[model samples]
Target chain A: MTTPPTTVPSTDIEVRGLTKSFGGFLAVDDLSFRVEPGRITGFLGPNGSGKTTTLRMLLGLIRPTAGQGLIGGRRYAELPAPLTTVGAALEATNFHPGRSGRDHLRVLAGTHGIPDSRVDAMLELVGIPAAARKRAGGYSMGMRQRLGLAAALLGDPRVLILDEPSNGLDPEGIRWLRGLLRHLAGEGRTILVSSHLLGEVEQTVDDVVIIANGHLVRQGTIEQLHGDPATLVRAADPAHLAEALHGQGITAEPATEHGPGALRALTGDMVRIGDVALVAGVAVHELRPLRTDLERLFLELTEAPAHRNRNLTGDATPSTSTEEQA
Target chain B: MTALIRTELRKYATTRLAWGMALAMFLLGAIFSGGFGALYVYGSLTPDGTPVSEVVPPLVLARLVYTAGIQVAYLLALIIGVLSIGQEFRHKTISGTFLATPRRGRVVAAKVVALVVVGALNGVVHLLGCLLGGGVLLALSDLPVFPEPAELGRTLLLVLLVLALWALIGFGVGVLIPNQVAALSIAVAAAWIVEPLLGFGLTFLDGAEWLAKYFPSQATTATLDLFTGVDPEFARTLGGAEDPLAWWTAALVLLGYAAVMTVVGWLLTRSRDIA
Candidate 1:
C-alpha cells in the first residue's frame, strides 16, 4: 500500500430501481443510487434494512426481482474479469473452517490466474501476515475480518463492496481499516461499504446512501446532509428572542436541551435570524446555524415510520414520529 | 476452464476431509481384498486338502482378490463426491465461489473435472492397497500373482472409471440434497442398505432379472465382470445374468446415472441464489 498507487480503471456503481422480495416480504424496493469512483460511499442502514441484499445483488450473488444492480453500467455477471473489476467480501464467515487463511486467498487467486505473491501481499496489506497460516476456524473475529478484507483486495480490484467490514474490529483495528479504505479509495476505487451503524463510517465516507425498510431514506454527501438550516440562537432573553423570530416569520422554540436561553429555529436562514434579533433590540450574544448530528439524523431517518417519514425530500426537521412510535 | 478446474482441485486438496477419506479408502480396499482372498483360498484349501488354484483358475482368483475391496471402496468415492459440493454449501462458501466465477455452469464443470481427478487418485490408492494386500496373499496361495496381465490392466482401468463415476453420482446426490447430513445419510443408506437388498432380490426373485442389470451397483458389477473370462460357469453361479449387459454397455449405464445426477445438480445450482 505504501508503493505508488497503481492506476486502476475508474468504475461507478449504479443501483437502478432495484427491488428484491423473498416470499411475500420485500427486502429492497425500488432503491436507486450512484456511487462515483474515487469516493467511499457509506451504504448506511440499520440491521435488516436490505443493505446486504442490495450489495449481494450488485455482485450477482443474489438476483433482483426487478430492475438492476449494476457496476460500471453492466451487470456483475457480465464483467469480463469480475474479480479484477469488483471485489466483494460479503461476510467474514464465508470461508471453510479448515482452510488456512493463505490457502483461501490462493484458492480464489487461482481462478483469475492471480499470482501467489499477490495473495501474500494482500495478507500483509491487511495486517494479517502472522495469521496467514492459521486455520480460519481458529481466527479471532478481527483476524477473520482482516482475512476477508485480504481476500477482497487480492485481485487489486478497482471497486470494493464490503458488508459490515468493521463489525468485529477493535478501535485500533477500525482506525487501521479507516486508513486503509482511505488509501484504496484515494486510488480512484469505487468503494461501497455497507454498515448498520452510521457513526462507524460518518468520518470515513465522502457520500452516503441511507436506506430503511427497503426504501431509500437519503443519498448525498456528508456535508449536504449535515447542512441542516436549523439555527441555534442564544440570547439573554429567550422569550424576547422567540418573539422577535416569530415576528420575522421564522419559528423559534426554546431549546432547553442545548442550553438555557437558547432558541432553536425550526428552519430559517441564518442572516434572517441575526437581522431579526438586531432590529428587535434583543441582546443576541450568540447566533449560529446548528451542525446537525448526522448520527442522530441517521437513526431518526432509518427508525422513523416509513409512511410518515419525510426524509426523502431532505427535510431538515428531525421527525418526531419515531418518538411517538417509541 | 483449466484454471477453474485447477482451482477446484486446489480447494479439495486443502481440506483434511479428502485426505481422511483417502486413508479410509486404502484401508478398506486392503482389508476387504486381503480378507476375502484369504478366506476363499483357505476355505477351499481346508475342504480339499489341496491348493485352491486347482479348483479356481488363477486369473479368476486374482480378479476376485483384486476387486474384493472395491464394493466398499466405491462408497468412499461417492462420499467424496457428496462432500465436495456438500462442504461448500454447509460452509456457505458457495457464495464466494459464485462471486469469483459467476458462470455457474463453469463452476459445476470444474467441480466435475476435479472430482474425477480426485476419484482417480482414490482409485489409485485403493488399487495400491489391493495389490499390496491381495498380491501377497495370491502369491502365498501358490498361484500366479500376475495372472493375465492384459486382463489385469483392463480391470485396473475399469476400477478407476467405476470409482470416478461413483464420485460423480455422489456429486449429483450432494447437489440434489444440500444438507450434508441428510445427503450422506440417504446416499449411504440407499447405496449400502437398500441397493444391496434390491440387488439380492433381483438375483433370486422370479421374473426380476430384466430390471436388475440397470441398477447402478449391478451395472458396476457387470462393468468389471472379469470372472466370465476365466470361469463363466462359476461366475454365473455367483449371480451373472443369463443375458448380461456387455461391459461397455454397463459402463455406459453407470455413466448415464452420473450424467443425470450432474445435469440435475448443475441446474439446481446454476440459478439458485447463493445466499
Candidate 2:
C-alpha cells in the first residue's frame, strides 16, 4: 500500500475522436479519456470494450482510423526511442520461444543502446534470475509476465502501459507487481494498467476509467467514484424491521429471509440499524454493514441494458463521445 | 541502421534453429563429399593401363559444393530467413520489437541484411568443407594432388551466388507468409517438391517450355551452368523449342521474383499491425 511519490509526472494522456475499424466492425470508436500522471489509472472494461485495441493504438502498433492519442504531446511512433519514453507490456506472453528470458531483455536493451547489465539488473529486480537462462517457451505464464515487465523497464521509461499483467500471477506475485508499479510511479513515471479483474486493480489504482460497449462510462478518482457512503444492514424481526424503518422515514427493503424471524435489509446507513432495534424494542444479535467493492461498481457501470443489447446486436460501435472531466 | 543490424545478428546468433541448420548443412555436405570421393577413388583406377591423373577434382568438388553448398545452404538460408521475421509474429514478440524501435521499415531492412550475411557465411562454410573433404580424397587417391585454380574459383563463385539467392528467396517467402511453419513448408516444398514437379510437367506442355525456365529450381539449374561451363546445346534443350530465354535471362527472372517478394513483404511488414 505504498503511495506513489510526488515526483511522478502529473501530465495527462489525451485521446480524441480515436476510431479503429477492422473491416465493418469498429474495435475502438470516438473514445477519449485522460490518464493523469502521478496516479495509477485503472483502465477497466469488459473483454472486448476496446481496452487492448485502444492501448495498441496509443502505443502506435495500429493506426487510428480518424483520431489521435498523445503521450507528452506526441504520438507513440513519433517518439525517438519509444522504449525510453513509454514502457509497455500489452501481452504478458509476447516472447520468442528460442530466446532465453535474459536474452529477450538484452535484445530490447540493445535497441536503445542500453547496457547488457541492465538486463541482469531488471531480471533480478523482477525476481526471475533463476529462470533467466531458461528458454522463454519453458516459462510459466507468471514468469513470462515478469520477463515482459523487465523488458518494459529496460530504458527506465517515463510512461508505463500494462494490460492484465496479473493474469496468472500468484497472490504474492500480484502483490509484488503492485509494489513495483507504485515504485515506478513514485519515480515520476505515468502508469496506466488495465485488468478485467476489478478486485485485482482495486487497491492498486488511484483513479479509474471505466468503459462499456466501447463507450466511456466513468472516469475519476477512486475516492470520487467509490467514496459515497452506502451500506447494507440486516436484522432480526423482518416485518417489524420494515415497518419500524418506514415509520422512521428511513428507506429499507427486504434483502432476504434466512430463518424464522431473521431478515436482511438494503439500507444506506448502519446507524439506522441500532435506532431501528432500539425503537422496535428487539434484541439484535446479527447486524453487519456490507461495503461496496470494485466488483459491484464494475457490474453497475458495465451491466446496463443498453450495453447488453448493443453487444448482442453487434452494434457496439464506438460513439463519438470524447468527454473528459478531471 | 547499425543498431538494427546488430539486433538482427544478435537474434540470429542466439537462436537454436540457426545453429541446428548450420550444423546440418555442414554434416550433410561432408557425408556427400566423402561418399562421392570414395566412389571416385575406387572407380577411377586404370584397368590394364597406366593412370593418367588419379585425382578427379570435378566429381569430388561438384558433389561437395552442389550437395552441401547449393542444397544444404538453400535449406539453411530458408530456415534463417523464415525464423528471422516469422518467429517475431509466431511468438508475438513483434509487439515488444516494434514497441522498442517503432520504425518498422528499418527493422525489415535489417532482417534482409542479416539474412544476406548469413547466406554468405553459409557459402564460406560450404567452401571450407568442400576443400577439406576434397583435399583428403586427393591425398588418399594415387592422383596428382593439384587443384585447378580457374575451375575451383568458378565453382566457389557459383556456390556463393546460389546461397545468396537462397537467402533472398527465403526472405521474400518469410515476409509474405510471416509464419515460421508456413514459410518453412512453402520454402521446402518449392525447393524439394513443387519446382521439380513443375519443371517435369512443363517439359511436356505445348507452350510452357520457355516459361519453365523462370521457375526457381530451373533457374538455379540453369545458373549452375556458370560452374559446369555452359553447354550451348544443353542450354537450348532445357530452354525449350519455342522461345527459350538465355541462362542469364533465367537468372534475372529468379532475381525478379526475389525483388518483388521482398518489396511486397517489406510493405506488408511496414503497415501490418503486430499483435
Candidate 3:
C-alpha cells in the first residue's frame, strides 16, 4: 500500500480513431477528439449518439473495439495511479445503495491508503457533509449527483470525465457546477463533460464536439463553429424587397413570425445586404444580427442525421443512449 | 491485497443483510441444538435396541454436529457467501468496485478471503450454541454431560471446515447468478429441495445407492462424517443414512464444484461489459 499522491499533473486527453461495437451495432465509430489542458470540452450529441460509450472507453471502463483513448500520452489502464490522474463519474447512481456517502468514499480511499482527511475534504468539497452520514439509497437524484462529483474529485485528479453531470442538478447546483468547472479549467485541468442538452454545456465549455449516428459531425470552438451567423432585416414592402433580393441573385426568406415587415438573409454580410436593399429602393427598418445559440447551431449541424435516426426508430424524441446499452 | 481484503471485510460488516443473517444463524443453531438434545435425552439413541442411557459420546456429538453444524450452519454460510458478490451486483456497486481495482481477478480473490473469514466466525458461533444447548440437556437428563477433549476439538474443527466450504459454495453460486433475488432462490431451492429430492428419487433404481451418494447434500454429509471420524459400525446401524464416498473423494468433488463455478463466473464477468 502507498499514500495517495497529493499532486496530479495536469494532462490533455486524446482519443485517436476510437471505435466501440456492441455485437453487430457500432456505438462509437472512428471517433477522434482532443481535450486540451486548461479547457472545458463539451462532448455533445443526441441520445444514442455514443457519447457515454466514448467516455467509458476513455476511462478504461470498457475495452475499445479499435484504436485507443489516451490521457497525457498514456492509456488509462497503463497509468500507475489512475484515480489521481483521471477521475471519472461514468454514471451518477453507480455507488452502493446501502453505504453512507462518507463510507463509500472511504472504501475507495482505503484501497490506495488515502488518509481519512481526504474523505472529509471531499465531503466538504461537494457540500454533502450534512447528508454524509445518510445512506446513498435514500438520497435524491440531486444529492446523488453531488456524491458522484465528490467521488470523482476524491483523488484530486488532473483529468475529470463526467457524463450528463447536470441531469439531476437543480438550477442552483448547475450554476455551482458551471463555476467550479470554469475554476478547474482555470487551474490548467482538462475537463470532458458529455451531455445531450446543449443549453447545459453552452456556457461552461470552451470547445464543443457534436456527433450524430456514431460519427463526428462537427468539432471546433463555439465561435469557430457558429459560421455565417444569420441576421434579421425588416423592410418596407417585403414582397418588393424580396424581388429586389431575387434580382441580386441572393436568397432571402420572410421572417415567418416577424409579420409582413421583415425578411432574413441567411448570410451575416450586412454591408452587402444593405447595399442590396438600397438598390432595391427598399427602406430598412430593423437590421440586426442574431447571435446563434448552441442549440440552434447544434440542430443545424446534427439535425439531419438525428431526424433520419428518429425516423428509423419510429419515434419523435431522441432514443436513449450508451447508458441504456451494454 | 490486504487493502482489498480490508475493504471487503468492512463492506460485509457494514451491511444489515450480513449481520441479520448471522444473528439468524446463531439463533437457529441454538434452537436446533436444544431440540436435538431433547430428542437424545428421551428418544431411542440407536435403532439396534440400544438404551438412551447407553448412548456413547461419539454418537451424541455426531448427531449434534450433523444438525447444528452441517444442516443449519451450512445453509447460513451459503447465504453469507452468495451475498458477498450478489449484493454488489444487486446494488449496482460493481462499477465502483471495479473502478477502484481495475483488475477484476483481485476483487474475486478478496471476496473468497472475506467470505471464508466470515464463514469461520459463524462456524465458531454456531459451535458455541450447540455446546451450550446440548451440554445443558445432557446434564438435565443426568447422562454424561461432557465430552473428551479430542472429541470436542474434532467436532469444532469439522464444523469450521464445513462452514467455510459451504460459504465458498455460496460465493460460487452468487458469482454464477449475480442477480440477488434469483441467486438466493436458486441456492435455497437447490440446497433444501432439489438436491435431496434428486438423491431420494435416485434411490428407487437398482444399484442407485452409488449415484445417490454423489448428490450435493449427501456429499456434505460424507464430508461431516469423514471429518468427525464417524465409526463404520454406527454408520451401518442407521437405516436413514446412505453409503457415502470416501471422505477425501467427497472433499475433492465439493471443491471441484467450487473451482468450476468460480472459473465460469470469472469468465462471464470478464467478457461482458458492465452497464
Candidate 4:
C-alpha cells in the first residue's frame, strides 16, 4: 500500500445528473452540483430531503439509479485507495455496538493496511482518545459523533463527506468541529458536510448547495446566493420615490419583506440613493443596505411553492431554481 | 485480498460475540464428551471382569467419546458463521464496511475465508474439550485412549472440515436473511427441530428412507461413520440413516450446501444498496 500523504491532495467533488428512486418514491431527483477543493460546502436540505441518500451514493454505499457522483473525476468505488482518497462519515450510528471505538477504527484501517498509529492519532484528533477503549454501544450521541469523525479521518483522506455531522454535537463540540473542519479545509481538502439547518453551517461553509424534495434549489458561494448589492430605502412617498429613481436609471420596487411603503433600490450605495432622493424631492425615512438573512432565505427557498410542486412536473430540470425576492 | 481478509479477521476478533461463542462451544463439547464417556465406561464394565468387547468395541467407544461433542460444535460453528455477517447488518456497520472496501464481492470473499478459519479454530477448541474429558475416562477404564492414531487424526481433520462447512452454511444463511434475530431464530430452529423431525418422518415413508441420509445431521454421522466403525445396532437406536451414504458423498453434500448459500448470498449482496 502507498503511504498516507502527510498533506491531503486537493480533490473536487462532482455529482452529475444523479438520481435515486426507492420503488415509486424519488429520493434524489436528477441532482447535479460541484464542490471545489479547499472549501467547506454545506449540503443543506430539510429532513427527508435526500441529503443522506446523495452522500451514500457519492460514497458508493448506495448505487444511484442514474448518473454518477465523482471525486477528482473518478467514481468512489474506482479509487485505487478509496479510504485514503475519500473519508466519509455518513452517520454516527454506522458502528458495531459491541466493538470498542479504537477497534472499530482499526477494523476499517486494516482494510487499507493503515497502521494502528494512525488510528490512535485519529482518535486523538477527534478528541475521543479518552473514550477510545470504551465500547461504542455505550457512547453518547456526542461521543458517537466524535467516533464517527475519527473513523472518517483515519485514512488522512484528501476528501471528506459527512452527513448531518452536527446532529448530536453540543454547542462546545460544534465549535470544536467547526475549528477542525476549518483546519482540514485549510489544507486544501474538499469538505462536503450536510445539515438540515443553514444557520448551523452558515458561518463555517464558504459555499452552500441547497436542495429540497430531491431537486437543486440553489448552488453557489454564500455571497452569490446573497445576490448583488442592494439598498432598502423606505420613502415617505413610495410611488414618487420609485418614479424619481426610475428617471435616474435606478430601479426602485416595494420592499414587502421590510414592510409596506418601503422601497428597495437595486443599488448598494446609500449615499447615492440619498442623493437621488434629494434630487427627486423624495423624503426618505429608512436608508440602509439590505443584508440578506440567509436563515430566512433558506426557509423560503426550500419551502417555496415552485419547489414543492417540482416533482409533479415531467419536464422539470435539475438546474438551479430562480431565487424569488422575498 | 489479504488486506480484506485481515480486516475481516480483526472485525471478528474485536467483537465479544466470537469469543463468547467459542467459550460456549468448548463448554458444550466438554459436557457432551463427559456424558458420553461416563455412559461407555459404565456400560463396558462386567461382573465377570470380562469386558463386552464384541457388543461394543473399545475402539468404537473411544471414537464415540472423542467425537461426542461435535454434534453441538457444528451447530455452534453455524451460529458463529451467521453472526459474522448478520451482526454487521443488525448494527448497520455494513455501511462502513462497504465504504471501506466498496467491492462487495471482495468483502464477502474475505468474510468467507475468515469464518472458515474461525470455524476451524472452534473445531480445535471443541476437540481439546473432548480430549480432556473423554481421554481421562478411557484411560481410567484401562482401555486404549487413542486406539488408532492414524484413523483418529483423519477423523479429527474431517471433524474440522465439517465444522468449517457448517459455518459457511450459516454465513450463507445470514446473508440470505440479513435480520440477525430472524436469521438466528430460523437457522437454529431448522437445525435443532425441523431437520430431526423430517429425518424421523422420512423413516416411516416407504422407499423414502434413502433420502433421510442426505439430511445434514445424518450426513454428519455418515461422514464420521467412515472412521468411527460405530456399531450399526447402536447407531440405529440413535436415528442413524437406514442406509448410510459413502463418507465422501456425505462430505460433498455438506460442501454443496455451503457453496449454494455463499453464491446466492453473494448474488443478492452484489447490487443491494447498503442504506
Give each prediction's DockQ, rounded to 2 decimals: 0.79, 0.61, 0.47, 0.82
> What is the Cα-based lDDT of residue A151 in candidate 4?
87
Model 4 root mean square deviation, Cα atoms = 4.5
- Two-way TM-score contest, 2 vs 4, winner: 4
Off by over 4 Å in 4: A1-7, A230-289, A309-326, B43-54, B226-228
Quote the positional error of residue A111 for candidate 3 in Å: 1.4
What C-alpha lDDT, on a 0 to 100 scale, does residue A137 get in candidate 2? Answer: 87
lDDT for position B121 in model 2: 82
TM-score for each of the candidates: 0.89, 0.83, 0.86, 0.89
Across B112-215, the per-residue lDDT of candidate 3 in tens digits comes to 88877888888877776776676677667776555565755665676687688788888888888978889989999999899878877877888775887776
- Which lDDT tens digits does candidate 4 get at residues A106-199? 9999998989998888888888888899889999999999999988888878899988889899999999999988988888899999998998
Ranking by DockQ: 4, 1, 2, 3
Candidate 1 lDDT tens digits, A174-280: 99999999988988999999998888899899999999878999999987877746778889888987987788778888877767788889774878887888888
In lDDT terms, how accurate is model 3?
0.76
Cα deviation in Å at residue A116, candidate 3?
1.9
Error in Å for residue A212 of model 3: 2.0
Task: Report the error of model 2 at residue B275, Å.
Answer: 2.6
